[model samples]
Target: MKRTLISALVAGCVGLASFAAAAGTVVVNGSTTVLPAMQKISETFMAKHKDIQVSLSGGGSGHGIKSLMDKTTDVAMASRDMKPAEVENVKKNGGEAVRFTVAVDAIVPIVHPNNKVKDLSMQQIRDIYAGRITNWKDVGGADARITVVSRDSSSGTFETWEELVMKGERVQQRALLQASNGAVLQTVAKNPNAIGYVGLGYITKDIKGLTISGKAASAETALSREWPLARDLYLFTNGQPKGDTKTLIDYALSPEGQVSVKEVGFVPVPAKK
Candidate 1:
């Protein structure tokens, strides 16, 4: 009886050890623009590291950074850099925020396929969102009021647009506000007169992308910085990541992960020499 009990105890201990060895979770939260690519990366990472799992969610860039600062998430995905106040806040809490550039992206202005306007100069786009140019005909389209769609203030995309396109101007108070790239795409795709923008990765055949200042938004243009709306995508951590978090961050900057970035329609980071 004693020998049988010892054997059963040893078997149970081995099972518990196996279960503990296979369990780890990495939580990532942030930008909707980065969500798709990260989702792909996470899937690949998990397959190779069967012991680790990645949990991802997108509430916007601000939320992601906030999650990191609050110690609720292992990583934060962002379409924009951390703000000055955000960095200061981290320092106050005895933590440092570190940013990792993950990909290059172009904020492509999208309109419905039926819209006749194929291109708009930078100033024209600014004017349209500023509510200074309200009619489509003013910009070479039909004689209809342009429905301006914009991302909300919390979005990193919105900050980039405000910097590059809005140019110190505000998106007119009446413009429709969306929470995610996909939402903006859908809003514009369904309305011929609507104009909106999204990360290059979110572009689909359903919406037509407008050229700005005669330059199309493409991987080549974005990487070359020839596209005026080009910007870098980022991942943020409380500090230099360690363990599972570091592994994921390193993979994202790895060649294979960069391929996933390109596959998802964003420009890959330039390879290191």
Candidate 2:
């Protein structure tokens, strides 16, 4: 059979994998970081199902979670784990929220491909974001004011960056706020002096990904726990999945589905027994 392109609209933690999904339309909302993988998976899944439709929206993980609480979606993708308060809220709203680890994601520190500097330590990354290192020259690059790009507060990716990179200091207000992973890539790709953080899937030939603490970003690195900046990609379904939802979730976790995850530039989980 001839191969065809697959698409997915994922809103959550994204891992590298080959795209795959089952028949039927599934509504997903959450992290923009994972959209590439989701979009790819949707394409793969839709190819098989022929009749099912997947609608994807990205307003951040918070938005996805809220949409789940409101019964507006079938699945919610999240970058960060659910807060204690959020879990309670889900229960209160009669949502049977289940967290599924779909893929592994490395937080990619990217710059315009033209930048000369390469690897950075975690401390150096922190220094850059905290404004302690203000110039590209300070980091062994061209003499330019370091322009910082970031996601809005709604982004789960931003939350993770805060916990891992910012080390709790507030991000400076001067940073440019982007709405999604795509936006961040576009910004960094077009601006010579810009630096921004995005998910592993978003890093491409158009942008350059930096090494952090000497760890390189890759599926092998992330899956083996060798990458310090990587996290598990999650799909949250309120309670036990039913009907097509259950089938789709199963397909997503299946070997075929997982392979597509890697194809779409995410880290695939080990095959389950």
Candidate 3:
């Protein structure tokens, strides 16, 4: 619970004509999927700005929206956009919501390294998650139970699943609930019977990505909006930020932030040009 001051760590960039560290405290929450790169930005930004305090936390996008609505956090980092009703709820609760694009992410479907299934279409994935296709044999893999590791209800990844695959239906009672994307990746990587979806950043050597309808989940596809599962990552603020919140948001949208986006394995916005 040590407090970190932004200006103390981010002073060098003050005169760079990018983001001037304005004075004040800002709290950011949500998007554990993007936390690694976001945290990198926080460390670098804090080095250049000393007067502002920045606290970072993640409990998934749902936590981000909840904290914003309750007026507990100044910024919400989201792996996905807010749902329409969620936006309305924020306004009804006396909060103003504005979204800023921070980066791009893909929902990479993955399997254990040994699984022979290397490709799957979006429809096939949806069917698998919907309980309509219950075995790997049905998807051109081994004849296994096709145990699914899923982000818990509080996660934005789960929300994406509901919207894109489940089409608003509830998750089956048997879907294994994982606390975070990392956990899902870990579980799926270790369990041959497991299949899971994670953010592009979390797609690593431990688990192999499955091509979606012959297209791969990658930065190029994500930036071009070519991959059907690609999504724009976000930072949400309550109304317009005028101080440190604005500063951090500006830095995140700036070239430096986009570079960090790429460094952490996500597709940088604007294709890093």
Q: Is candidate 1 or candidate 2 better by lDDT?
A: 1
Query: What are the per-residue Cα lDDT tens digits for candidate 1 across 1-273?
Result: 122322332342232211111238778888988877787788788888888888767779998898888877888899999989999999999899999999999999999999989999999999999999999999889999999999999899999999999889999999999998878987997898999999998778889999987899899999999999999999999989989989999999999999888877889999889
By descending lDDT, how would the candidates be arranged? 1, 2, 3
Compared with the true structure, all predictions reach lDDT values of 0.86, 0.79, 0.77
TM-score of each: 0.91, 0.89, 0.86
Q: List ranges where model 1 is wrong by over 4 Å.
A: 1-23
Model 2 off-target regions past 4 Å?
1-24
lDDT of model 1 at residue 153? 90
Q: Judge candidate 3 against the unseen true structure and give its global Cα lDDT, from 0 to 1.
A: 0.77
RMSD of each: 11.3, 5.3, 6.9
Candidate 3 regions exceeding 4 Å error are 1-24, 271-273
